[model samples]
Target: MSPTILAAILSVGVSAIATEVDSPQTQASIAVPANPDNETFAPLTPIAQIPDNSGDSSDKILEQINHYSNEPNALDQVTNVSQLRDVSPGDWAYEALRSLVERYGCIAGYPDGTYRGNRAMTRYEFAAGLNACLQQIERLIAGTNGVDGGDLETLQRLIQEFEAELATLGARVDNLEGRVAFLEDNQFSTTTKLSGEVIFGLAGVAAGEDVNGDDIDNVTIFGHRTRLELNTSFTGEDVLRTRLQAEGLGSLTEQTITPEGDLFFAGATDSDVVVDALLYDFPLGENTRVVLDANAGASDDFASTVNPFLDGDGGSGALSRFGTRHSIYYYLDGAGIGINHAFGDKLELSAGYLASEAADPGDDTGIFNGPYGALAQILFKPSDRLNIGLTYIHAYNRDTDTGSQLSNFRSFTEDAIGNAVPTSSNSYGVELSWQLSDRFALGGWVGYTQTTTLSTLGGQIDRGDLDIWNWAVSLAFPDLGKEGNVAGILVGMEPKVTDSSVNIPGIDTEDEDTSLHIEAFYQYQLTDNIAITPGIIWLTAPDHDNDNEDIVIGAIRTTFSF
Candidate 1:
């Protein structure tokens, strides 16, 4: 029993002992986010974490390992033989078990609630128990207090009987120890992990026409967006992230006179990889977090958009840019800093400022003078499934980030109200998300921005304000067809100039009508690391003008993550 059980336990258990002794930790399973900011349904967790090397390995492994058998599976440690219900005074090995329990304080390796002396124990199981007893006895010999002579004699006899088995176990453990040390010495980074996502899309303008009656091109294009993230946690609680991205997906909005059909993942890097995002987030106290973005930071990085299921981040959520989050969030981007403070479980506040030219050193082009957005928001959560956010943004010289060029600035308002003239806007938005049930959710947002032309072209025009409005409603079905599937429908109005005081072509403004945007997408998680989404977007008007023909954009996207 001892020879077989002890060998099996020690052999397989040595690797565990080596791991424990070296204290090389495996990371806790915190699903690595496809977009690290998001913790919910992030993606396949494959990155290995190097744990904090601390604590005693031998003590931990020794307590659980058995000799040659693996079957003495127990969780609780028994200090007294009586704690093991199967053992009685009439048992033949009762005195030996009592001696190990009370004298040397060994035998804590017993499985939970049993002492099955009648059963045949495997080598793995014996080695596990033997490992614990050996460690306890070793300590006794090293201490000056000395062990009891009678118990020592009994231990000596047992040692003599298992001397050959013990020698083999020692050699195996030593070899494992060397292997563990080698791994510890060669690991790449103890503080950093790499996770990435790659996306391939086949997209095209399926239908449309310009206001001038020109037919839209129906050419299909294949493109890709790839991102690799370097996530570093300096203090375990704080994270420093750097994202490198290469995106070639063209905006389908380019197919029409309006930008309403632009894909959320669409971007032009000219196919060259660039540093897409860099930020460091650390906790200030128990409920406050501070983030410093050196480049390409968006408002969603800090403020609560309140639309969890649709904050696309390019790959995980919706398909169109307008479908991702409130248009107000698009105003806050570039380099910036932000802070989030929670008042309690039900309420929170966030504030941040970003500058498009924060790095420019020239006069009138630096952080304070360049295009920038300052934002403040209040988030309310009445329950685990509902979130509401009220947001306000103040900006100078920045256009609406996800709208038509006409909506970006009052069209024909002399230099487009953006290029030659400085523009100032105050935007307000309200966003709400409610998970109605495990399978269904509702979310939406309404945003309004009032902009005043700064230049007025040297008194040629009045510095009147323009009113722009946009809103959308979404219905989300989670696990629609499969466990990891999601189907979503979005219906909304694109940003349109409802009332413009800025003069354009002999009138205050001719901006009229509303452009309706309807979109639907179903993301099917093909595997832990892959998702395929097919979606379509319909635009009712080319730039809030019914004179233009309606347009449709179609796409099939595939995403891979690790």
Candidate 2:
């Protein structure tokens, strides 16, 4: 009976944690004029020619005016120009005249069929005309500024004046200059980005037995478990990353129970960390690539509270050789380098090796001597819709880590009876995936593993090996309202069955265990920069006698760009 179980039950009345959300403010309106006093507002119609009209010039002018007026708005009459009647004498017509000239070009008229000198433009009219002028200038600068004799100086001066007015109006267009640069280079360019995800979750056991194989007696809530990562990039082609994770046994209530029956809350410490990356981009052809990577850390596909890879970092699970609970997840941890490459549109290949360390004699480190084993894999994808893969691994168990140590966290340990046992093992597996459409996809993997153990004290033990498999499918909506925003759901599951044997000197037992896991996630985009995601996980482990195994996890996050 672990003491931490009781502590979790006591904290049931505690409040759930809260998350923060950021909302964007709507922009306020600004007032400016499209036509300034200094500009002339005129239609393409030529001066009503007196009898002195020259060479079809009148016809050409009329054609131009009719072409420009063909659209909804036309400058046939001066009233189409913006009005700024509040101009006081000697005031900075710098902004006023700029507005007028922008509206009519040179000369402007009035709505009464004449230019009204004293008619004051209301706030609404002023804002509309000003916005129109700004939009036109922006388009001209974007389209003509790079052409020969495109009046670059005029465009610059106009941009500066508009910017000044915008600033004075308290409408700060933050990073507008950067935006201009980005738009200017919209043709062919590359950008590198660094991003990461943080996950915090809680897990509870409804009914479960202990390591002693006792009848079901306790329900425990475990963890303050969290995962963190740091990512880096060089050019769009290179990437480097690091990750750290931790989980503890204690909380606001109590930690663990004592052999003599004491209550306590034993807080947590460092769980595991990893540092790794590709040395350089491996190019196979124009479009194919292959890369190499090396790293060390601990992780799990779904949950890590029960058995963390670096469990050696603390507590009773700390680095041990024999006695410790052995789970498939824990055995899968180790560092190795791998090769991944895609050729043309048809073939792809990948494979890697992992070396496991030895634990102290008191735990099941699966290590008999030095480094444990190695793994290799290959994958083929003929198209985006289909994929097939295979993997092979050879593992070595040592009797002791006394003579050699290959790497950190992966060495050999002795058994309880001082036996330096060792094991030689091999495993084979296959993988597959299918993207039925842009909105949905499915995937799965399966494998069979076997092991042979030999020891100076226990002779030889042959384990019957086991089989494992995982499957998943997902769907998403396209127009979810932009990036960071997604609508739809994802569902996945894994079913496991293991039939194997262990030969210990005094005890030999056949073990058969099975478990099933189901999970789902839904995401909602609140705005361009904010999103909310909610998910749930359910597990049924007959071997552990757990029921109603449900866990909830979700997050509210906001992102910003510079």
Candidate 3:
């Protein structure tokens, strides 16, 4: 018999008698020899004993092999026995193959759809079939469907073992969701934000020699100031700021000084709330901006003040206004409009007009009627650490005194005979600041003003031209003791009557003496939004006369912000 026919007959016999074995001895009993031609077919020994000469049987086996090889193997692709064209319900392996194909999607059929179960087979064919079945079993074990009772039990056991880890992951996801909801619900406004600050101050002043050389007793006072600001932005490049403030601190008792020694937090002594500032600023182009100030202060529209450490009102700087900036900045204190244009990042031009009574229509009041101050300034920043400003101001009837001894020109010109004087003045100033290191800086400004009396009523009393000058140097230590802390020292002459030729016949019209103002302060940051500052100011020869006793001002201020 041909080897190919013998192999086909043995394959059919093996399939016909195949059984699930539980022991090695049972598997060995049905195992086919590796080479069927050389070794006897052990599994088929009991089934039939082949005759030495059996040509007729060999011819029958060859014909069967040829027929099976030519037929299709429908079980290779069909999902069910009913889809097969030739397999019958009586086939021995029909139920097993159907179960595998339908449950695991492992089977594929030939194009003709016939199950050629009588085909000869090789060991390679057996390996390919086993591989497909094993892969299908793995898919059933991993997924949620088409699993038997044993597989379902195994998946449940795995889920129970990892229950704690799964619960932790779910809880983390829930926490993130809650945080997002809270942020969305509690946000303030889409285009605007509200912020506030409250300052409480304990201040005391020891009066120096009065005008008559009498010693005045020391006075102590407590005061509070609160400010609420709303910052709104329509476009990303513009800002609208509205601020409301209330304060109740009376004026200082000692009044002979030029700047009046007003508390930094002093405002309406009756504790009435007022709109302190209303300003809208928008970009004109890439390098220019226009500012509309319904009510603006002198410091509102200026660039850097040269003395940064002494500029803040109640929080982190000098307690006295005289120590903050040059007296020339005191020329304007009410409503105004301004513009700022930058030439690259190093230079800027700023100009503004402010009228003290811009909102009043009474005599000597109104936007352009009377009592206005106009200013123009050119600010230059040559490097990251240096800044300079050249400023000029034309003021009408605006007080120049800011509680500093050198600012007596304004007091001398206005408070002469207890009547307001119609005066026009022109002021020129130069301010500069240099950062010497990461934590130390030096700043100073020199200002000159020429006042012209315009009232005819003061015919020869105090009418003429007056020349006033003031200069100061400031040293600042930023982050002195810790981050956000500052220490500052100011030494300067307040507005001084440099040369006066007032034609007052019966009164002394010449001012030949100049006084020195020395101030020191340290600010300590208690928290991100809170600070405490302790400051002291000493004036030698106050009121432009060495005969006056030295004046001392001390204050402790606490500020809270949100």
Candidate with better lDDT, 2 vs 3 = 3
RMSD of 2: 21.6
What C-alpha lDDT values do all the predictions have? 0.71, 0.33, 0.65
- Once superposed on the true structure, which residue ranges of model 2 sit more than 4 Å away at CA? 1-196, 210-230, 233-236, 244-294, 297-334, 356-369, 397-421, 460-502, 505-508, 512-514, 518-541, 544-562
Per residue, candidate 2 scores C-alpha lDDT tens digits across 168-211 of 22232234456767866872324333443332222233333332
Model 3 TM-score (2 dp): 0.67
- Estimate the TM-score for candidate 1: 0.72
Off by over 4 Å in 3: 1-180, 253-257, 260-262, 403-414, 458-462
User: Residue 237: error of model 3 in Å?
Assistant: 2.1
Q: Ten-residue segment with the worst summed lDDT in candidate 2?
A: 14-23
Off by over 4 Å in 1: 1-134, 146-186, 211-213, 410-419, 507-510
Which candidate number maximizes lDDT?
1
lDDT of 3 by residue, 1-562 (tens): 2222222232332111121111222210111122323333343342234332223343454343233323332223455757656555554445444544455544444456654445444322322233333345566557786456654453343234323333332444366579868978997888888999998888777657555577756768788888899999999789899999888776563444345344556555677888888888899989888878888555446445666677885555877767777778778778878888899989989888888888898987898987888888898999989999999999988766553332344455445555555778999999988989989999999998888878755463656777877888999999988999989998887776667666655656555666778888889999999999988888777666777777777888899999
Q: What's the residue-level lDDT of 531 in candidate 3?
A: 94
